[model samples]
Target: MKLSQLKILDAIVSSQSLKQAAEKCHKTQPALTMAMQKLEQDIGFTLIDRSGYRLKLTPAGERFYKQAKRVLSGCDELDKISSTLALGYEPSICIAYEQLAGDQRISQLFGNVIQQFPRTQFKIVGGSRFQAVEKLAKGEVDIGIGPWFDIFHASGDFQSVLLKPIDVILVASPKILANGRTTLTSDELDDIPCLTLKPTELPFDDEKLSFAKGSQVVMVEELATLRSLLLQGVGWGLAAKHVCKTELENGDLVQIRLSDDEDQFQSELRAFRSNRNFYGPVASAIWQGLQELY
Candidate 1:
């Protein structure tokens, strides 16, 4: 009938005797009995079995308590949300990160930020090339972290901080370069398929990412899929160094040096948020934490 009565019933159901329940609830046994008696009278049914040595819930009591427990759990959550709101924290935040940025690093960043604001919910999503920026533009996410592109800078709608540069090296499976060639020319790769991230938007220049002028291009929606295809010798393409560090070291995938000056690629990653709307404390904390961690 009341939250206090339900709480007393919960304690009684959990304990071995009325005396124990009274001790747990910080009340006298008589007061505890009186409370339950009032509650049962209001509910129009007996809620406890008193014939046994240890008190137990009646069949009806068991059903009623099941729902009561959910109410208590929700109350606890509401209390936490109210406290968090009082401190001006966002209840939830969503972040979109480019796959090339490395998952382990992002996980570490999340771990650090979570320790600071444990009640704030976080939704992390891995995206393909330029996908993070696209999500930011569409207001689909609270924050975006990925390689800095001219388009992002030109937009002027985002506030950004530059992080460390990520190295992107051209690589291929050893089987694809079994000829023992230490370096390759664009013409040499002309016949191979280039596995690349599919463009998320139109009017984007694919030429800037092309390694071979005549190579057949395979558009992949995810980096994991592209890496798997590269491992199978399906194609040669650019990959982030950290993403393929183990494979490159084990000789499963070999870096193909281009004859031209562009064999190795490096791009700075940026953490940015939309300038259109004001962000809450949690979003601001995460954005600052990212800049510090990176």
Candidate 2:
């Protein structure tokens, strides 16, 4: 019937002892028992089964407790919303990123934003190319960071900037190299399987320069998974220089050079923000900070 009484019931159910519930509520046991009795009288039902040593909720009591917990949760969320609004901070913002967004750089840039606006909360979502772009176009996120392909569609309202380029080198397990040569011909590469990013959007083509276009290729959803496949000698694939630096250094994988220098591949990382969303003080700071990060 009352919010405080519901809270008491929640404490009792959670602690499983009336005395413990009284302690949690910071009240004397007798006063707590009296409040509970008054609640039951108002509701006209037995809310607890006291026949056992540990207090248990009766059938009806269980149902009431479940609804009471939801009410409490709603109350907490309302408090949070009110506090955030009072502080003049945005409720929440999401950043959708491609899996290749280097975690270290992202973290460092965000650290500066957090220092300036500690109350601002950030939600990061990472996925493959098409998925990240779609989330941004649909207004599911405020910003996006990923490899930018001209073919990926974006509306006129979206503003974008090209970040630093990420070098993508073809790599495979050293064991996969048959001739013990650092360079391989395109025809030779076409013979073995090459892990490739699965297309998720329309009018898909082998956009990036690749030698394994028509060769035995495995379509994958993420670079990390593709690296795993390459590590096991499952196939060769183009990977970001940052992601494969450790593996290449430790001899877990080796970069393959193409005999034709023209076949080199590189993708420019880009950031996008929808102009429709009002960039509040915090969002504006973040948006500007990201552009300067690159």
Candidate 3:
């Protein structure tokens, strides 16, 4: 019933010898045995089979040991969280991001931040476009990284800092660009389907989005899915330079340069945080890390 008794029980089960369990628990063999006896009496069941040379658990004893182990694990986690809280650290920091954010850079930034705050829990959530911003505003995430233009104008509840420009070039599978043409005109794009990401919080269509004027369009929520569809020659749409770098180099896909300078594709990515004056220690560290990363 007591935590100490559970520890003794677990030690006995693991060591398979009462003598070894007592040494491991830093208690005398008699004290450990008496504790086990009291526990069995309290539970109204025998926990161990002493007839064997090596300590063995009864069928019921195995079940109780398993549950006790889980309880001990929970206690350990509770202690860790409590210790982190006492040190003025947030228990967790969640970040939600759009696919256009550079994965390699994000990985590096996160790794550095984690090393600095070893006790802080981290969660990364991915969605298309403004979804990350919505999560930040709703307090579902501590930080949001994605396109900023629309998001900046859409919400006053959050503050944002420009991180970097995401270079999105129109691209399609080689088969879709079978004509071997480097340039695509607006008229040509009308006949070809355009794969695009669907914003989780806003309308499907954004007039300001690059190539939004394409007549044939397919909307999806994840960039990975759109990439897969593009590789299948389903359509053509603007893709992050880093995301399609391998494909572009391998000739599996090729960029479609816009014929008009007026239609050049590019978007700015920014890190957004809630406007609240206080960000928990972990979240504040993450925000500063992101600022330095860009």
Task: Identify the candidate with maximal TM-score.
Answer: 1
Count of backbone collisions in candidate 1:
0
Model 2 per-residue lDDT tens digits across residues 134-248: 7776556878888777666534266778778888788889888897676988877788798888765433534453456657768887767887889999988877888788999
| lDDT of each candidate versus the true structure | 0.80, 0.77, 0.78
Tell how far residue 70 is off in model 1, in angstroms: 41
Ranking by lDDT: 1, 3, 2
lDDT of 2 at 78: 68
Tens-place lDDT digits, model 3, residues 112-136: 8888888778888888767877676
User: Which pairs clash in the backbone of model 1?
Assistant: none
Among residues 3 or more apart in sequence or in different chains, the pairs in candidate 2 whose N, CA or C atoms overlap within 3 Å are none
Encode model 1's per-residue lDDT on 229-266: one tens digit a residue.
99999989888887799999999899888786578877
lDDT measured at residue 177 in model 2 versus the true structure, 0 to 100: 87
**How many steric clashes between backbone atoms does each model show?**
0, 0, 0
Stretches of model 2 off by over 4 angstroms after superposition? 1-87, 153-156, 202-211
lDDT of model 2 at position 126: 81
TM-scores, one per candidate: 0.66, 0.63, 0.64
- Report the Cα lDDT for candidate 1: 0.80
Would you list the rank order by TM-score, best first?
A: 1, 3, 2
